[model samples]
Target: MKRVLNLVLQSAKPRTVGSLIFSRNKQKMAVSPSLNSLSKVPKSSSPKPQIFNLLTTTPKTHFKFTPIFKQSTLSLFTAGHANQKPTIKHHSNSSTRCLFTGIVEEMGEVKQLGVADHGGFDLKIHANTVLDGVKLGDSIAVNGACMTVTDFDKRLNEFTIGLSPETLRTTALVELEPGWKVNLERALRSVDRVGGHFMQGHVDGTGEIVGMEMEGDGLWVKIKTEKSLLQFIVPKGSIAIDGTSLTVLNVFDDESCFNIMLVGYTQKHVVLPLKKVGQKVNLEVDVLGKYVERLLGAYKTS
Candidate 1:
C-alpha cells in the first residue's frame, strides 16, 4: 500500500496536483506556481491589478471609473441633435407696436387765450384730422395727449380744444409749435374690441419729454415722469403717454423722474419724441396700477 501511494504521488505533475487540490477545496488551497502554470495564467505585470484597485478599493465618490462588464448604452430617438439650435417663429405685430392715423401729424399751435386759478387754459389747435370727420366733444390725441374736440372747422381743417393749466403743465402740447407733429388715436368704444384701452380722455398728469436725438437709424426719445408713477412702471412696462403705449425704462427711487427709453424704431414709426424741452406729455399711469393697488390693499387688510 505504501509503495503504491508513493508511485501515484510521483506520477502526478505539480500543476495537476495543485488543480486537483484546488477543485476539491479551493478555500484551503494557497495560490502557487504549479496552479499558475496550469490555467494559462495572466502575466504578473498586467495592468489588471491597478484597474482592480481603481474600481474596488478607491472610494466610488472619489473616482468615476465604470467597469466594462457593467457598462450600459444610451439611445436617443429624437429627430435633431442634442446641441442643435432651435428655430424661432416671428409674429407680425408685437404688443409693443402702436399704430396711428395721418390727420393730426404735426404738433398743433397752442394759444392760451385765458387761464383759471385751477390750472385751466383756453387753447386752440389747428389740425387737419381734428377737423375731419370729427365733431364737438369727440376725443382726439393731441401731442400724445387725449383731448375732446370741443369745436372744429370743416373748410379750414382746423379745431379748438380747452386745456387746463394743469393739462398744459402735464403735456408736451403745452409748448407746441404750429408745425410740430402730434400722435392721434380715437377713444375706444364698447363696440370696439378695446384695441388699446379704456382711455378716460382725461390726463392724470404730465411728464417732461427730454433727451431726444437720433440713435442708429431710428430716433431715441426719453421722458421723465414723477416718482409716484415709478413703482407702477417696470422695464418694458406699459404706460400711456398721450394715449400711446410707451415702454418704461431705468426707474430710480431718489430721483423724482422715471426715465422712459424709446428705441429708434418707435421714433420713426411712432410719434414719441416730436416735442421740445419743457413740453408736457400727458401721462396715464398703466391700468394695471389700479389692480395692483387693490391686491396690495387686500393683502394688508387680510
Candidate 2:
C-alpha cells in the first residue's frame, strides 16, 4: 500500500507541469495582434508602422496611376510638335499698260538731219527746255519715243534727245530744227482720265509724213508705213502718230504707206495740219501685239 501511493503522487506532479505550459502558450497568442487586427488599431497607437507603409506604398501608386486628362494633354502636345503652318503668297498690284508722266524740259534744236547708216539719223537738239522745268534725270518722249533729257538751255526752250539711226530713215522729225513746231503732251497719270489709247511712249520706228492738203475746210494727211506694219494697218483702224490718235483714211495695197484723211475740225484742234512732207513721225505699231504674243506663247506650252 505505501509503494502504490508514491507512484501515483509522481505521475500527478508531471501532469500538472504539462497543463501549466500549455495554458501560458495560449495566453501569449491571444494578447498578440494579427495583420487584420493591426489595420483596425488607432493610428495614434501605431504611428511608426503607419508612416512607413505610407512612404513606401504612396510612391508605387503614384508611379502606376495614369489619369485620362494627362493622356489627352500629352496627345495634344505631340500633335502640335508634329504639325506645320501653311504658307501664303502675295501678288503685285500694277497694270502692264501703266504710262509714266514726262514733262518737257526743253525745246531741242536740230543740229543735223538725213538718213542714217542703220536707217535713222543722229538728231542734235540744242534747247533750254531742259534747264527751265526739266532736270538732267527727267524722261521725255521725243515724237513719242521715251528719251532722257540729256542737255538743257535755260535761256531758250531747248533740250536734246538722241534720235536713233532708224528714226531718221523713217520719220519727218529727222529734218526738224530750232524754228520747227513740236506737238507736246504730258504723260497720263493714274488719276487722270484716259482720253486716248494706252500709249507706252515707246516708238517702234518712224514713218514718213507724206502730205498735208486742205480739202473743203478739212485737212488730209498721208503717212507711209514699213512693210512689217502693213498687215496690221487697216482703213479706220486706230493709229497713233507722234502720240496723237489718228484714223486711217485709205490703206492702199499698191503703196507701202497709208493715208490719214483728217476732218477740218481735227486739223484745227490738233497739229495734223502742221505735218509736212519728208518730216519724220514717231510710230507705235499696236497694243494687240502683246495679246497675240501671249496667245502664241500659251499655245506652244500646251
Candidate 3:
C-alpha cells in the first residue's frame, strides 16, 4: 500500500528541513535529511531558497504533503492515491440536445423496397448537398416529426429511420402510402442561421387540409384541427406544416382553422403541395409559447 509523491524545496544556506513520512502505526513523522545527503546540495548565500525538486523512494505508502514556499504554496496529489473516483452529474441548464426547429430542406418518398421487419417505412431522401455534413445517429425532422437515424448508405446518400409503435399513433406519418411525398429537414445545427422560429419537431396535433387557394405566385393552405391545439396558433406567428416552417396568415373557426402561406420557392421544394386538400398534415407550433405559459403559471403561484 505505497503511494508516490513529489516534493519541491527552495532552500539556501539554512537550517535542515524535514521530509514527510507516514508511519504504519498511524502517525505522521517528519524525518530530516541525512548530513551526507544535505552536504551534496550547492551552498547559496541568497536570502531566498533556491528551487529544487526531488522524487524520494520512501518505504511508507499513502502520504500527502504541502511544501512551504517563499512566494506561495500549493498541494498536489499523484494518480497513485485513490481515495475516490470522479462522478458526472446532470445539470438542468445544460443543452437539451434533441431540440429541432422545423425548417425543411429536402423531400423524399417512403419506399416499400427496403421496409424493415419492425414495420418502419423507408425514406429515399437525397441528402447529398444540404446535409453534406450530417453524420450517423443524428435526428431528422420528417413531416414536422422527429425521427432518429438507424442506418446510412454513404454511396447512395440515404438514411433509414425505424419508427416505433408510439410514433405511428401520434403522427400523421401513419397515413403515408407508398410513393407518398414526405418533407425532410435535418436537425438544427448550432451554427445555423436560425431563419425560422424555435421548433422541437414535436407534432402536438394533426391537422386536416381544408382547401388550397392560389394567391399570386404562392399558395395558401387552410388547415383544420381540434380546439386543444388551436389555442397556440396566432396570426402572423410561426407554424410548421408537414415540417416546413411557415407563418400563420389567419386563424378562424374559433381558432380551430389556420392558414399557412407558402411562397413559390417553398411550394416548389416542399412535398406539401403534392398532397390533395382532403389529406391530413403534420402540424407543429413554436415552443416559445409553451415556455411563456409555464413561466406565467410559476409567477401566478408565487
Among the numbered candidates, top lDDT falls to: 3
Clashes of each: 15, 20, 0
Best by TM-score: 3
**Candidate 1 — which residues are off by over 4 angstroms?**
1-120, 165-173, 177-180, 190-198, 254-271, 277-279, 298-302
TM-score of each: 0.52, 0.51, 0.64
Rank by TM-score (best first) = 3, 1, 2
What's the lDDT for candidate 2?
A: 0.57
Model 3 error, position 91 (Å): 12
Candidate 1 per-residue lDDT, tens place, 19-114, comes to 343222335534333433565554435435344465456554865667665634442433455567776887543212333322223444443345
Candidate 1 Cα deviation (angstroms), residue 273:
2.4
> 1 or 2, which is superior by TM-score?
1
lDDT of 2 by residue, 1-302 (tens): 55664575556542322222111232342223333342443432445543444424444443664443455766765766566765576553222333533222223345544444556434445543334456664555555555555455556555555566555555556557655555454445578766566666666667777777777876777777777776667787767777666767788767788887767655554444676687667777666865676788899999
Model 3, global lDDT: 0.70
Per residue, candidate 3 scores C-alpha lDDT tens digits across 79-114 of 434577765886532123555566677777665434
Query: Which residue pairs overlap in candidate 3's backbone?
Result: none
